[model samples]
Target: MTWTDATLEDLVLLQRGFDITKAEQRDGQIPVISSSGVQSYHNVAKVKGPGVIVGRKGSVGTVYYCETDYWPHDTTLWSKDLKGNDAKFVAYFLRTLNLDRFDTGNSNPTLNRNHIHGQPIKKPDLPTQQRIASILSAYDDLIENNRRRITLLEQAARLLYREWFVHLRFPGHETAKIVDGLPEGWTHCSFAQMAQYLNGFAFKPRHLGENGLPIVKIPELKAGILEKTPRYEGSEVPDKYLLNDGDLIFSWSGTLAVDFWNSGAAYLNQHLFKVTPSVGFSAAFLLVAIRECMPVFMGKAVGATMKHIRRSALDEVMHLLPQGHILADFNHRASELYDQVQLLRAQNQKLTRARDLLLPRLMDGRIPV
Candidate 1:
């Protein structure tokens, strides 16, 4: 391996992004890339394809790669020119520079692209740059494939659920007599009747600590616990609020959703509920049911800013339940597909960790390309 001394500007030139407001955006295919990544689409593009964007304002230091022309939002600084260097390699190398350090000493933290260019750093040859990018990209490519597979698996389960339950097209539906808009041996029950919806305990700022159970909130359900996640190290939390693997979690208040907790032990936070299946219900069935009715839940939610579902909404959303045998049969099929989704998610998690660890080492040439 060989390295040469060069300033940051010699390899890649960073420039402030264009400004666009949500109201000005129109329906189109171009992504409105912001500091936090793409949050909307626009009809026009400000930067050409194969661009690298770094967060300049909020979510400072985050990096994003785009393959197609994009609208870089004002809160970011994007690579205007790669100066013949491999784009992916530059993106990875930038991550090692700790650009977040430049974000301090301001009321609103921001990264200054102009101020960061003069520092001298090592530069790998073009061949080495391409090789390093190839190696790192391999890990990310597989993770992305697993994510696609996970999405497909979840979609399959959701569709099957809708067909069997929502549409009342279960296997034996042909022979079962329709009694009062439902098949025979079926009962309509409230959402609460089928599951134990225990809301998470509210943890104040004082309860936060360096270690313990990571607090699981509504949005936190998907990412699980991360290194920066706040944990509850204060007084002992009740046994009921502690999350276990495969526990069904529901965000009832804002952004209603259902997710299974696969990450390690976590303390459930307010606005979220640890849902447990009752007598004849299963996690698989409940997941599909809640998703199908999410629109209704969203409509029922009331608030000026942070819309939330009232507890009574659970009683309002009733589901039709079939005989024990039929319910069990559906659960068995759905769980199989649901299990695959969880497995893929777990694989992606591990791959992400491995890639992050290998990143700094590869950038510094510790590991031979």
Candidate 2:
């Protein structure tokens, strides 16, 4: 059977998302889908699910799929009408279009509905749509399951860190001595002392290419190295800037985050800190500690346009450190958890690459449903 040659309008109707200010938002479970996926949550949902969303403002053509009812924010374009197409299939099909090419802005890339709605797209019939979606969704289903497991594992690690470090509830707290609001054999350590923060060297546009070491920017940090991520084919960037797998990455500016790198070695771009624990510090400890410092870092971030925490913030935020014996004991427990997380993350990356490779082949009819 031949697939129909049609415009995007024939498959689905894309409309500008509704507007909702941050002040108007309240705590809830309904995801507020923006151009960058789910950034916030709302008490009420604006659209029914499952929905397909394409970035129209900031992220520029990035695609997102939501399973539950959600509010599509002003920065995105959501499918108002599926037009009898499988929603999941439409989501995967849009990914193969390379919609970012439709960007019409010079400085800030933007996606306009009018520009793409009349564009040509080859789509199959309803039955084929469902079959393709089913095959692809099987991959998604496994990815999502692993994602939940990762979340639970991370939560367990965080709780363990907090319980032993913050709340002072530890294995033998009953017998521990306390003095001047400090436990015996405990001393405060600043964030700066805990790890070495090596900011990545700034690389220019011409440095990027289709091959070589993948560059690690804030976007790549948030969403690993995606299909569209820029690569550096140039000469040796300084050794300090090359980050290996399982290294700690701290993005001090623009959506502050602390996470361990799961992808293989990549070039570290500016606005990212490649953190290495000090001689006495452990990677697992700093990973959790830095995450806990996010609120304080956010409070000190200074910028009207783009908020960012300075290096001074690291020195300002301090935490109590136990003696070597206690620290080593904690590291032993945390390392096991961190190792499990790394294993799962590495597995997810392989699964993602496999699915992404299969998607274009399946969508292009190279692999029939």
Candidate 3:
């Protein structure tokens, strides 16, 4: 089946979603599908779902599909005409269409319902469409499976760390002399005791660029890991903003989770902090422990204003120390798993990059489907 079989005219373009008002956007259980992705709040009535959704306005060519009930936000367009293509198939086909080609509004460059519905997309027959979709979907399945496996591996490592460190269960627990039921050599320590937390320097928004030194920001921290990063040149950063690799980056002001950096040299934003694991301590172990203890910290954190975990507050909290031999053993075991997880994660990242690069070529007739 060639793309010549289907045209944009064959696609039945549904009207754009109704404008979701701000007031109605909150306290609703509906998923607000916008140009970006699923967002909170709702104002518009939902229509045909478990189908393809394309961005008709703000982000002219962006494409999205849903497997469950969803309300399209005003910034996007929904298909009214399935035109024999499986909703999923059409969604993929639309993704291949060059959005820039269909863009009309010079200032906004939007694709309204009329423009998109009338657009030409050469689609294959239904069976062929399904077959192509199946092929592409297999790749997607592998991607999703890799994601789930990574999550499970990470969770298993975390659970083991919690059981040993948080629960204080180890080889020495039974035989070590006990004081108040804790092992004789074991004692409580603060986060400051185990790691020194250093805050980053300030940089105004204007000085920041998109492709320079990787800047770790507060909003980018999640689950004791770094996700999105801001790029800034070293020249742009103040002398104090520099951070070394192996330093655990933390969102000191907003989020409390700490993420370690084993990548190229990077800078930390004002709200970010660096945690230097004390001598003989595993930075990875401390990061996992912080994540495990965040719930307890959140519960005890006090503030009507923005909730945050201050260094002083963190310093006062007690850290349960596992016996030396036990801690070493746990670190050795968990480190092995973590190293493997990291390797798999790196491979998955490479795979995803390769797939994303190939997607456009495959979608367009550039690379034969």
| Alpha carbon lDDT of each predicted model | 0.87, 0.89, 0.69
Best by TM-score: 1
Which parts of model 2 have CA positions greater than 4 angstroms off? 25-29, 105-109, 202-210, 226-230, 233-236, 253-255, 298-316
Q: Candidate 2 — which pairs collide?
A: none
Candidates in descending lDDT order: 2, 1, 3
lDDT of 1 by residue, 107-166 (tens): 887888877888788899999999999999999899989989988888888888888887
For candidate 2, write residues 178-221 as lDDT tens digits.
98887888899899998899998899888889899899888888
Q: What's the TM-score of every candidate structure?
A: 0.91, 0.88, 0.73
In angstroms, give how far residue 112 of model 1 lies from its true place.
2.5
Q: How does model 1 fare in lDDT?
A: 0.87
TM-score of 2: 0.88
lDDT of 1 at 109: 78
